[model samples]
Target: MHKFHKSIFREYDIRGVVNETLYPTDAYHIGRRYGTLVDSRLGGKKICVGYDGRLSSPALAAELIRGLKDSGMDVVELGLGPTPMVYYSVFELDADGGIMITGSHNPPSHNGFKIMLGKDSLFGAEIAGLEKITEYKEGFGSVTKLNIKTRYIMRLLQDCIIEDGYKIGWDPGNGASGEIVQKLCKALPGKHFLINEKIDGKFPAHHPDPTIPENLEQLAELVSKNKLDVGFAFDGDGDRLGIIDEKGDIIWGDQLLAILAQEVLAENPGATIIADVKSSRLFEEEVSRLGGKPLIWKTGHSLIKTKMKEMQAPLAGEMSAHIFFADKYYGFDDGIYAALRFLNIMQNSGKTASELLRALPRYYSSLEYRIPCKESDKLKIISDLKNALKVKKASFSDIDGVRVNYEDSWWLLRASNTGNYLVARFEAKTEKKLAELEATLSGFLAEYGYFLEV
Candidate 1:
């Protein structure tokens, strides 16, 4: 029996540093366990497996497939592509379950698995149960290799109807989305300028996380140099997205959500639109103004997806750039698909990206701040903070974390589900109020001996 580290099984997925917290043997065990779960519990036989551009992904995927075959589970092998392609295969191929071997926005040295069983992601208690599996079934199972790239691209193209030939800039940041971006651009009606389109596990051009403003410098430069209408960037596994306007100013995730919501609301009035708790107040206000019901839910992608299903929401997004559209397509976060949807909106509106997004009310907002904390202490700190807030009679929502609401400002502090850190953000109508809110949050953390610097 392999003794898997508890830390690797996160709230959302299985992830860890390669050869350290995670290994080939671990991947094999995971496959054996997951295959058994799929067959015995879900009564499923076919599973689709895909990998990202990470160097360690192929070997891990190969071992995983072997273990799955050993457990008598037939595998549809999606050779190499983004995480969303694996998700697409589940629906397009009508498979029982799926798994994408990716590290997402994490560094090159890390790798992990994002899993689905019957279209819904395996998370929370389901993920926790993987550690307890001790038995594996042995039998012969077949493997079918599949190339889903062209079909996936065609699906995206068919969904979007772009008539305008707007000059667009794209930066895949040398991640899994590189090839897909290149192919999609060729088919779309636009003057496309793309950088770092080569799929490289090393991520030579920059870190693949577009959420970090530093990583988007190259894309901004590309947009500015060409005087393009807009720019887009993708993360490591091409699940999250980042955007730059004509002036090379970044359209943050909440702002982008506001733009997308306008189009969605027009099509489906009074439809529930979900945003993560970390999203700005402007998003909620905009959705309400557009006659759409706004819901602020938990932060993780899987959690949000489940909530979307429960509420039957047409559109949903996070501050981290994970946008899901159930309006006209499958409700999975796909960077390429989102980029096209935005392009279609731009084309139909005959407006520049800046003009389309300029109407969103602005606030003095801080970028997401991550503070390192021990995995063991993360939950405890949050619990203590909540208790402290309760005693103070603070106006806050504890949906995912504690988001303290004020008359003209709000701030959020939550433990990151994917890492050993506490993530925080602040927004206010004025800079002084933003500073005051930061101070208030810092003072609260000080009680727990976690001093924060604004």
Candidate 2:
């Protein structure tokens, strides 16, 4: 029996530092356990496997495939690509399920797996069940290697109808989205400039996460230097996106979602659109004003995806830049596809990216603030805060954590599902209100020995 670290089995996926909390043996065990679950519970026999550009990914994927074969589950090996490619392979090939070996915006020293069972992402309890493997199978299953890149690119390009003329910049940040972006750019009609297009596991250019404003600096410079219409950056596994406008300004996730929502609402009026709790309330107001129903749900990608499916929402997004479109495409988060959609909107609107985004009503908001805390204490702190809020009789929403709502201001403090930190955000009609909300939330945290600076 292989004993695995409990910390690796996170709420969303199995992830940990390589050679420390995670190893190839652990990957094998995960594959075996997941294979058993798929075979017995889901009545599935075949599974698709793919990996990212992380250095540890290929080895982990090999061991995982070995374990799956040992457990009598056939593997369709998608050699190397973004996480969404594995997801696309699952649907395009009509496979039972899929798994992508990726750290996904984490540092180079870390690696993990994003799993799916029958088109639905396994989360919370399903992910927890993978911590132990009690079942075993004897037969050896087959393995077939497949390259779905061309078909995947074609699918993305099919719906993208944009004329040739605009100047655009792309920065993959040396992550797994490089090769596909290179190919897609060739087929795209425009003056496309690319940087850090090589898929290197070391991420020599910078960390692939665009959510951090620092990561967008290079792309912003590129856009500014070239006077491009817009610039786009993708996360490590190409699920999340970041955008830079002509003025070298960062268009945040909610802002981008609001821009896309206009087009979606124009086509499908009164459709339900979902945004996570951490997103700006302006997104909710914008959606409602456009004749679309807005739903605020939990913050995790898996949670939001599941909620979108349940509500049959045409579009959904997060402050972290994970945008999902189900209106005319598969309901999965794909950075490349979202970029193309944004381009399509830009071409049709005849407005620069900044112009369209700046037209939206703005509010004073803070970037996501992560307060470091022990993983074990994260939930406890949130629980205590909830109790304290209840005693105060404050108006708040406890769907994910505690999002205290005011008439013209709001603040959110939630334990991050993927990290040992409490994530917080504040927004208000004015800077004064924003400061008051921040100070209020800060006072709450100070009681718990966690000091928040601004």
Best by lDDT: 2
Model 2 bad stretches (over 4 Å): none
Candidate 2 lDDT over 1-454, as tens digits, reads 7799878988889999999999999989888888888887878879999999999999999999999998889999999899888888999998899999999999999999999999989889999987755767655898999999999999999889999998999999888999999999999988999999999999999999999999999999999899999999999999999999999999999988988998899999999999999999889889999999999999888888899899999999999999999979888999999999999999889999999888888899999999998877899988998898899899999999889998898999999888889999999999999998888888878887887877
List TM-score per model, in order.
0.98, 0.98
Whole-model alpha-carbon lDDT for candidate 2? 0.92
Q: Relative to the true structure, how large is the alpha-carbon lDDT of every model? A: 0.91, 0.92
RMSD per candidate (Å) reads 1.1, 1.0
lDDT of 1 by residue, 246-290 (tens): 988999888888889988999999999999988999998899999
Lowest lDDT 10-residue stretch of candidate 2: 130-139
In candidate 2, the residue pairs with backbone N, CA or C atoms under 3 Å apart (3 or more residues apart, or in different chains) clash, namely none
